[model samples]
Target: GYKGDQIRDFFLTYGDQGRDVTVNLASGGSPQWYGDPQTEDWEVTLVETGTGARIKRVAAYLDQPYFLQTYGDGIGNVDIGALYTQHVASGLVSTVTGVHPTSRFGEMHVSGERVTEFNEKPTMADGWVSGGFFAHKREMVDRYLDDDPDLLLEKKPMQTLASDGELGVFTHEGFWMGMDTFRDWTELNGLWDSGDAAWKVWA
Candidate 1:
């Protein structure tokens, strides 16, 4: 939703309050942590890189053996700890969170030209898709991912990983939705306003 530097600036202000904030404007940018370290429940870091940089370039800053990645547009009640545990148990280079996506069109059941039942935007009964909550070992970047700035994560890297049998999947049957449209934005806001947001797993 936020364009240009709006998202970065918002987080910078939010993190700068009652805490120190530092930003690096160089290549291979450093970790820009937000919020107070002692009291904050989670850590937020904004890593700056060149425009049109590849995902692997940004990932080069990752110092940990394992890390998570996801698109900002999707929200869900995915269990992060469980995902990490599954990744470890599977011993794969990466683990992708798969979800049954809701259909864009309404479903209708008919018998002899008589409308029997109808469901609006129902969740599909078959097939799971990547919901973007990815848990990856550092080896994935070292092996599968490339240094090309034009490389897309969903393209060659994922394809190669699956072909190599190193990509595991963690299926999450709970609430998940992607905010790619205005309708989705309104629906998510309505849920939050009505206090019925299923993705709000925290107190």
Candidate 2:
């Protein structure tokens, strides 16, 4: 697992019953998972924190656009590879993809010396890092903010870093998902409520 203090700022969870806790974006949009009703779902691993019960990590199937819109603005923009390229070219980032490349989804092709390309696939590691539920150091946050005032930590910095080859990635050997639209949310939620969600971590 990634280590750092800034990880505290990235996720949110709510509990209604012992087994009815819900997790989603902490600061933006409605607090619901996004994507296809049948496939867009999350598996939450809870751990004890100083604050109380908190999510350790989440295994999620998300809708790309919805995830980007919800968390993307905070980071910068959601184009993982493009954002990183921009940062690297401008000296805004130092390391890209902290973890292995295989941890990422979507089309991320590395071309000639220091050149990379991103495809239209929704969840690729093009301009962003593999940060879902991962932790971060407080120093990283300070470095990120000091560089860009308009920076949305979740969206812009990762892209900026990737552009500069300073972003780090955490490859997870597990299931993942994304939901990009309202319809996707509906479908995923229906499946979750029906107890057939493939991404369910509760039961």
Candidate 3:
């Protein structure tokens, strides 16, 4: 079974502070980028579940040019920016910002041609991009979930979506962390006890 509360918490943590965000859960493989190639846009971030570290800025975009698959090992093998570039070069996608990786977190960043400047570091100043939290629009769900049963909605889907510009990012300006192992869980609990969880929402 899925951790409904955890899902709820995750969505609430990323949802707009005062707006209503609907989270739909379906039994499947993963979620994919679904939106108009011309209008939708988004960004990607690497979140380490064990250490709760938002390693780097990954990618950004607004179409379904590529798809990444997650095997049994749990790690995703996404080319990050290759798909978008191919699409843009081939004219399948509009002329948008190119994709690049960051230094601190080793994540990728994608921007449109209109995106004049780029930030190297993640901070509360940049809507907490380094924190790995995001604020997505309702349309993200509507397009991504277009009655796809096999869609798992996992990390790969997110990566592909962000890379394709189907999702937008609303970085949070607080503590954030991901728990992927027993050690990480313990450490996160300790941080919570000491009042230092970056992703703490109910505190």
> How many residue pairs clash per model?
0, 53, 26
**What digit string (tens of lDDT, one per residue) describes model 2 on residues 1-203?**
23323443333322212233245556655544444333325553333233211111121322121111122111211334443444345432233322212232356567666538766434434443342433333334444443333434446565665565655443433334445457557756787799767555443
After superposition, candidate 1 runs with Cα above 4 Å error = 1-4, 15-38, 41-43, 50-53
Candidate 3 structure quality by residue, lDDT tens digits, 113-181: 465555643432322222222223334444444333344454544666767865433222233344456
Best TM-score goes to which candidate?
1
Q: Compose the digit string of candidate 1's lDDT tens values, residues 62-120.
A: 88899888788998999999999999889899999999999989999999999899999
For model 1, the run of ten residues with the poorest summed lDDT: 46-55
lDDT of 1 at 155: 84
Could you tell me the lDDT of residue 87 within candidate 2?
36
Candidate 2 at 70: error in angstroms? 10
The deviation in Å at residue 134 for candidate 2 is 3.5
Model 3, global lDDT = 0.38
Quantify all predictions' global Cα lDDT against the true fold. 0.83, 0.39, 0.38
Give every collision pair in model 1: none
Using lDDT, give the best candidate's number.
Answer: 1
| Stretches of candidate 2 exceeding 4 Å from the true structure | 1-131, 146-150, 163-165
